[model samples]
Target: MIVAIKYPNGQPYHDSTHQPLSKKAADSKPVQHGHRGMSLEQELNRANEFYLQRGIANIHKKPTPIQIVHVDYPKRAAAKITEAYFQQASTTDYNGIYQGHYLDFDAKETNSPTAFPLNNLHQHQVTHLLDTKRLGGISFLIIRFTKYQETYCVPIDAINQFWERRKTERQSIPYQAIVQHGVLIQPSLYPSLPYLEAVDHII
Candidate 1:
């Protein structure tokens, strides 16, 4: 989604002119509900860093390419970037090489007791993963059942099936189905999530 200069808080601005958040959907930040007590992003970043360091996998978070509209050039040596906006994300959250295979996937956490909401994914992302899978790439979604404290590695094809027929099926993958078909990823230290272990077992 293209956005103008906006802070992490979702506050808006037009060239540093603060606009009133009158009717904006400014919801409070959601708490991280996982074993390691870290946000999903933080844990994945730490895992990626650890994997890169040990030369295990080169997975990395895809940065949201942004267009800088304005900058405060207080000094020539170091320009203070004051205003910038993010363009729409075209692919999944994380992508890289792992054990001679291409990896493309996204991570999501749900507090619901039974089913994981399919709306966590976008149409473009589903299409991207399907395309990658067609080329023999490893694609999946790392979903955390926060309240249950269990993580499941659901294959991209399964997600694709649901997404493509979502209009007709209109169904969410329940916890029971996840356990039946999903690969369980046990938690660990250092990398915190140790999802690679599960991937290894599956592949």
Candidate 2:
């Protein structure tokens, strides 16, 4: 029989491990929500900015890129570009050095109570994460169970299982499975992701 487990905080789990497991790993990137004056993404970006200002740590979302196709030699010191194209993202959303450790992670969100879709993840991200792990870097995924208003820190080892089981449509990791292997996190204004706390528990 498939057993159900619940954490003390009232979240459900898959079994004894307490990390949520699903077929899909990281699904669509999660966007911040519900700040009247600002978009959720804007609010979180501001929070990230504030954290950077406080010198608590240096972590920033990866920047968007634009390709240059045409240029005009306008001056001796400057050139003007006439054509450009937006470039696809090459890495996970957020990454940087924290507490002398190299940190790499991505944020994803799903409204599903049962699963966090694997469709949210990309092949390149899996490759990047694998490389980081080999180099002794701290690599993980940040998942937001939007329905429950809960977030979790999922490690790569658990993530790899979903990667290995890629032959089926059961892609997204269910919230119950997440509760099995992942560490629950409650983000706050001051600390933002509060990943360090989760990292402490995980390592």
Candidate 3:
């Protein structure tokens, strides 16, 4: 069974081996839930903005292209988009430059405790990330375990390996594998997810 561990005062609640510590022995407060209601997209947007303000990195979310089919305009009012459909998005969610390296990644959140379902990712996304990696760009997936309020930055190479193993393996990547191979990130007040720090270790 999965037991949620709360980290108060931004301290690491887990041991070096990532085993959750006993709550009774640790003097800590409860996990704050103020930002829990926000969606992952909103969190990334805020984090990107934080990065930009600090002049540390310049990253932005890719806007989804919409094919507007119909629009109604009133003489004294603004036009309203009536009908529209999404154009196929080619690349990952966010891409930009950081420390002279091209960065590309997709953000995902899962509620599952045992494993992360492969179905959450698309074949096109995998191909895009692989191509980016081949081109010498840093590519990865930012996965958040929403249930545990834990987040990790997993390299594209690791993802590619599991992605290829799907042919003969299970449809999901086990959580233990992720913890072993992925970089765990502590959420911060600014640059919220602070994923780039994990990237620092990777590169």
Best by TM-score: 3
Instruction: Give the TM-scores of the predictions, in the order they appear.
Output: 0.78, 0.69, 0.80
lDDT of 2 by residue, 60-120 (tens): 7887778989988754434556799998777777787767778787877787889888888
Better lDDT candidate (2, 3): 3
| Top-lDDT structure, candidate number | 3
Please provide, for model 1 over 73-133, each residue's C-alpha lDDT reduced to its tens digit, 9 standing for 90 to 100: 6533345567898898888989999999998889998998898878877888888888988
Ranking by TM-score: 3, 1, 2
* Stretch of 10 with least lDDT, candidate 2: 17-26
Candidate 3 — number of clashing residue pairs? Answer: 0
Residue 48 accuracy (lDDT) in model 1? 78
Greater lDDT among 1 and 2 belongs to 1
Scored by CA lDDT, what does every candidate get? 0.76, 0.69, 0.79
Worst lDDT 10-window in candidate 3? 17-26
